[model samples]
Target: MKLNISDRKKKVINRMYKITLVIIGMVIVLFNDTFGRLEGFVEFLALYFILILITVAYWIFKQIKSIIQLKNEKEKTELLHLKSQVNPHFFFNTLNNLYGLMEKDSKAREMVLKLSDMMRYSIYEGDKEWVTIKEEVDYLKNYIELQDLRYHKKSDIQFSVQVVNFEVKVMPLLFIILVENAFKHGLENLEKNAYIHMNLSESNNTVNFEIENNFEIRHNSDHQGIGLKNLKRRLALVYPKKHTLTIDEANNKYKVALTIKIK
Candidate 1:
């Protein structure tokens, strides 16, 4: 892709600024000792050398800092791009479910309403880094309701939430991927005794989320895609040391537990 003109200019300007600092340091170090009398030259040389060392070190330090900052910004941008990519798959599945519902169910209208609320949230709020826990919890409920409509009450899915504070903010769509994964891989294939259980609870500024479901053994290529990886990457980007995600499977049942400390 072609770089934007403004971005190209900004890059050029940043390079020039760094180069200018380096050149200024070089000039100060090389020329300061040349313009002093011999008697004072030794003292001048000592002070000048110290000043030059400090100047060069400061410039190098700034250069290293700038490089790290740029690298982090680039990684953050790429992570956001990956997060954006996960949405299309979700939209595709939801629309397919809605299409199936429209053919026979009058409740499709209600489903559409719920889906529209989710669509609005995705379109407007998805781009944001953080949203209130209340907003995210509501989004999760709407999503579960939509999935319930699709499943036609065949699956035993339950979601419960206890919030100590609604004002806490968290990264948008952080937990939905696990819920979607549960539906897509675990509950969708089971013909009997299908179940999904989810809980979200907050205490002491930390949010705990858990989802578990059972599935029949089956091989599907699409199940191993980048959704979970993207979710992990987003968690790393947003929460870093303050988050933990664990997944366990046994007896044809899978569970995912995620904990995040709100900032």
Candidate 2:
């Protein structure tokens, strides 16, 4: 049987009511006849009342815990749903750009075709909660290469992943999303000598990621785009209060740093 939360709560509530009524009856019966006559019975009833109170309190605590768990699960579901959209949106846009590249540059077309593997992973494996750091790093490399082919401008764009080891696992597409965002919003048609740098490191159970990009900073801006907003939302859902994230933008330079611990 599928037991809804309300049903289980009502059942607990009814049990509590029955216990309360029984205790009231016991108190009435104890006071009426056994007031000064019975010595031990009154003490026993008092102890029983204390036990009943304790049991009710325990049940209430458990109910509160269950409610908290439900809320967390709901938030996780929503975060995953949001994450699911990012890859396809990125793919369609990149593929359209790739189509334009195909018209004249056969080499660019061939390079863009390699993106299909990343697209496959984004569509299939990216759905999972976490993926190996090696996979994520490889994907980031391909993404950077794609941008390199598209940019047509050189010497300004520098990107690399600095890490000690590549065996650990992390939330898939987490760092990659930020890299994509840097290229999307920061790189402009007017700007020359734009630059982006990224580093990743892991020790024990903590993973650190830092990225900085030099862009044409527009005046009076709240933030960059939905991608960065989505990145923050994902971090919140996956890490909650356990992780640390910071972003700094000053004098036309943007930097983001994130530290996540796997427990």
Candidate 3:
């Protein structure tokens, strides 16, 4: 469940206020002169039990609220670190592509413009909690075009995106990590018949993205690279139970499918 930090804090404060009222009621019962007699003492005993129950319940609630807030903070911190990691890794790859374009004396001007668009999007839109589906798709297109410039005729790649609702929002750059992984692990080293197929479709306020790529497996390479691991962490932090991620590997093909329920 996505929780608002302010709303959670307000609940904690309200519970604490209820606890204070319970304490005040207990003090009033102990000090009132009308409660000195036996009947009054009996009333005090019953009231004490009720007050104790309220206090215990409030205390438990406060503790649970504190724990949840702490967990959210930790997740946000980890996600921020992961976001920082993405920029450098992305720039590193793109810069290498730019260098290759320069070396080949290819369309450096067009590639630079595409790179600039990606950089502007990452700097401006990527930092936000959510971005429109159209913006993200444009960014992905730029990234793919840049990748295409870097490796021409060496790999077969198909990308298709269909959006039923253009206003749909999602966490920015979440799917790019998967695309980067496909290129890094699958397309870079394959000598022939390398293929990457990606399809994205959105319906009923849910987005589904799937990527499949064929690659030569390396025994020494880690399957869960930093980008994939960070992507999983970000998904857990942002979507919680509202997302599904699946990975399958067989016949030298790696397939990943992610479904996200969006607001």
What is residue 16's positional error in candidate 3, in angstroms?
26
Tens-place lDDT digits, model 1, residues 159-187: 98988998898888877888888888877
Per-residue lDDT of model 2, residues 51-161, tens digit only:
999999999999999999989877875665456344565566667777677777777656766687787767776878778888887787778777777667763566555
Model 2 spans > 4 angstroms off: 1-30, 33-72, 84-89, 219-225
Cα lDDT, all candidates: 0.80, 0.74, 0.81
Q: Please provide TM-scores, in order, for all candidate models, with all chains considered together.
A: 0.71, 0.70, 0.71
Quote the lDDT for 236 in model 1.
Answer: 74
Candidate 1, residue 233: how far the Cα is off, in Å: 1.8
Candidate 3 ranges with C-alpha deviation above 4 Å: 1-81, 84-90, 96-106
Instruction: Give the deviation of candidate 2 from the true structure as CA RMSD.
Output: 9.5
User: How far out, in Å, is residue 151 in model 3?
Assistant: 3.0
Candidate with best lDDT: 3
> Which of the two candidates, 1 or 3, achieves a greater lDDT against the reference?
3
- Count of clashes, each model: 0, 0, 0
Report lDDT (Cα) of residue 54, candidate 3.
100
